[model samples]
Target: MLPLLVLVTLASIAALYVRGDLNPILCDGPCGPQYVTPPEGLATQSPDPDEAAAVGSGPIDGRELAAAVAGPLRSEALGGRTSLVAVDARDGKVLVDEGDGAQIPASTTKLLTAVAVLDAWGPDARFTTSVVRDGGRLVLVGGGDPYLTDAKSKGSSVERADLATLAAATAKKAGRGPVTLGYDVSLFEGPEVSPAWEDGYVGSVVAPVSPLWIDRGRVGAGRSTDPAADAARRFAELLRARGVEVTGEPTETRASGATIATVRSAPLSRIVEQFLADSDNEVAEVLLRQAALKAGQPGSFAGGAKVVSQVLSEAGVDTAGLVINDGSGLSRKNRISARTLAEAMAEVSSTPRLGSILSGLPVGGFSGTLENRYVRSGQARGLVRAKTGTLTGVHALSGLVTLSGGRPVAFALMSDDTKDVNPFVTQAALDRVVAAMADCACGA
Candidate 1:
């Protein structure tokens, strides 16, 4: 009898899967939500190179959109913490709903951090991981440069070749005798993984998020029981064994405003672009700290949060239902609502700094976190640009979606404190919502 019951349940689940009720729908067809049809003036493809950009940047009505998105979102199984906000970046429209404010941002907090950093430090700024000749000892001082890698690309955490090259360059520059090489990581003041960051989360490579490292924040390629700092030590030691001589202890440095050798990143704008597109936590954290520093505060989580609050207040965005634990949104304690995010999105979109934020967004059906998402949904495929967030019980996508009439719509949807709901499901729901917007001729 028990076996039969199990079979029945399995059969029902299968039936739901077949009926498109069990999983979130992605593409437009009989399987997914209806395709959103552009109203009139909106371009279905990329804007023509010769086209003049439109600017009016009216305020977005986030409250209305929030109501629509939240009604269905919260009705689902979230982990009692959820946030969603959508802002029509082009026109400064807010379409959002109110939910838990201080929910953990996870990687989503990276967006805020990235933008603030760009604003604080011009895009051309480069972080320096210096190779200094301190008497008989050669020290590789870390300037918190996140992109010192052997690979000629962003997000490639492996910097063996690059480190090797730098070491070789240093050796060649020295031109004689063995010089002791020391790895200095004194720029950052604490552990790579924050006390607020979960240990298990920090342990993984995906979160391979570290305090500071050269190669775009990649951990050494292996499994280890050591903490993040330990990994840094091992990496440094590996460099040493690789023919880079060392005499002094391999330790984290605490030097500031000191220059040895500088390795510039691919512009702050580029970093932010990749960050939003890839949803990189390490880049986000660095950017956040940089922002704090820019805002005349310590470049730390707490400092960044304070800066964010100040920015929001100055920008006249309502922070009634907002709590930021960390800029990366990795914290489960970070809370935000669709309304707040929408407001922010709208304002940022209208500002001259829109490029930093918009350029970073993952193009729907193309790159970044949304690379594999919304591929089949024709209306949302190339038409939607957004950021995606996911945690154990949370799934969110927020950004801009351009529709007909050259009108852009912003939307954020988040689900937290839920049971057994995957990101795919939430993505399906979001796709449907975007499709609905696409098909609507609201402005037309």
Candidate 2:
């Protein structure tokens, strides 16, 4: 005879399946900074130019690189100031060093967070969400799974750990009697919302940085004010649906219980891929916390920022005058020199364990944030893989590009004084600068 637990779990699955509750849906679809439609006939997985370019093909010609980038840098579209640093990724040879002072970096800050987290936990590391029972109460504890979902599998849209699966497993173990559900959100420290954030950020830009959230704490089209409570409540509803009597509303409390059911998110490599390729702010913030926890620090803004700098410094990336206020670079307070950003890129590019830190970045003009960009730089298309940064007056691109001679170089380009200039014109100029570099075959 089949065990009662196995029979109960099977029954729950059939019931949910019959109701079509397990249908695969697009949760993280191309909405809100994830719109990555392939450019016409070219698919995202098409053979890339970088793959064909041989590594270590250059002893870059400093004077040639300077001459190649000079005209584009002087464009009036760049406003009054620009900072640029380009270095060979293989041997760390400085090719062109233009502003060496710390400057504001926008979404490109995800690069630093990606590198730190990847170093702390290798590409195969995963986050787990589990449930436990103490007496008659059940507690749902979150361990910072960024891709935790309340729906069914998301296919390739994302790496998901669906709560429905957990619900099915839990229903088999718990008794059918009434029981209270509790949730623990003590994994992360205070200040759920950053003080430096703009007023409009919470609802649209991102939701609160909670360790426990479903669908990134979304309710319809808006963000949830209390993601953990909402998640716990959902768990209770699922348990009840499976014939397990849930008592009152789920409450917040420190939980100590025996294991009941658990689920784990995809590997950290896949997480970092989504982060860089799509510039996923939620994942970036969660990864920063993971980095902090690895350093034995509290999972909060301050602790994460401190660890980011320390990790980079210890990796031999120059962190002088680097001020990291947040992991997503959404804050205007974050500052780092272009040279520092370039060095960080080089460090990641050369390290074997952190290869995704570069490979996962969106291909310029082909995918990710750069899909609409580089329209005018055909020669540079599919050749450049870089993280883009943008704010009101700041536009930055820090990434890797291979030359016509097959030499790979990491570059950081920032222009913060573009308030008076048209954004398109500045971006075009930036693209042209990279195109010029790609055309330079002076490595011989």
Candidate 3:
């Protein structure tokens, strides 16, 4: 018990300090210091391949479930554009569709990003950032790891694929003194910001979509302007501190040679867990490109979007009305249907290779982006696992929930008309709707 308590504490501190998600605007104050009862049983093992089906495999009364959820969605705060869906995952039975069908998903779009990356790379894969030799120069290579931390960073294995680690090994191998440093950021291509994204989103909303970054692209209150360059420069500083001389500023390059030292990100499963729990925009963007590269496509906004669509098709998750202008869904041009979002949750719950996706969704009142949420939800606290989304007009929730009857259900609730409403009001309305589902005995 103490182990779990200590673990949760460390994770929370790291999240608060490191992820820089504490921005007053990005983190709704409701994502609390207000902790609730933790989950009944937090399983670390993999679920059965057919668990979603096994749990939800029964005659589902869709009408009963729909009737139960109707009143909550009627809340004026949600606006008229609300979209909702609840699917009995196993049988593909939808229990509700009580509002307009599709809307902007905001960070909930990370769900699609999660599915695409897991599908392409498999769960155990890790991203590697290496220090490689190029004649007298040492080139720091970015393998698209957004969690790569700089030296002197406080990190666990999952957080600190530290540049300091790479620097030590490089210095030892190079045998003393000076080396010109360059960075290879050719891994990702196209405009750093998606064409559909706002000009101001680059530093504030996310770091430039460079394959390399340190501290998850976080700078003071925002993100680094040139993440790749910033990372290279940080690496040089680490090397210099280690008594190795770095000649000149790190320059960009394409001619990287024999690897000097390599540091790897945590496996895809762990990476997926952190990014989803935190609603990390930077990690989502990088994963999009990584998946694109695996599929022989450009590792750019368009390419990642293309690969995401292809992988969803392969996983049998519907992508209808899914328009992805960028991997992170920061772009208002992105559009996804409630049906598609719910089905993606269903696939994550049901598929074997895709299993890690569910484990990563933030627990309703305990961790990640959800820490301050669900305070008003009764038994739903700590029981719900979902990815939350927030944009000016956009508010969304999508993931799995278990009914009072223990029937596991996949659901999505989304809206774009809430810009006129207080963000907290709309978010609370969505939570009430989900909490009602948790407490319902709809099968009877």
Q: In lDDT terms, which candidate is top?
A: 2
Tens-digit lDDT track of model 2 for 204-265: 87888989998877789778878888899899888888988998999998889798998998
Q: Encode model 3's per-residue lDDT on 1-444: one tens digit a residue.
A: 999999999999767744444433333221222232223342211234465445454566778777777899889999879888888877777778664655788888889988888888999898899888877898888888778887644334357478888888888887665789999998999988787987788788788888888888899999888888888888889899888888899999985479979988878877888788777888888998998999899999899889888887876766777899877779888998998888888888888778877877887776677777864446477557888888898899999877655677899999898878999889888888888887776653
Off by over 4 Å in 1: 1-104, 151-161, 205-211, 220-245, 253-260
**Model 3 ranges with Cα > 4 A deviation:** 1-57, 152-157, 376-379
**RMSD to truth, every model:** 12.4, 8.9, 7.4
lDDT of 1 by residue, 195-253 (tens): 66666765353333333454454546632333234434544564565555555556544
Model 3 collision count: 4
Question: In terms of TM-score, which candidate is strongest?
Answer: 2
Worst 10 residues of 3 by lDDT: 28-37
TM-score between candidate 2 and the true structure: 0.87
TM-score of each prediction = 0.73, 0.87, 0.85
Candidate 3 residue 52 Cα shift, in angstroms, is 16
Judged by whole-model lDDT over C-alpha atoms, candidate 3 comes out at 0.80
Scored by Cα lDDT, where does model 2 land? 0.82
Looking at model 2, residue 54 earns an lDDT score of 46
Number of the candidate with higher lDDT, 2 or 3 = 2
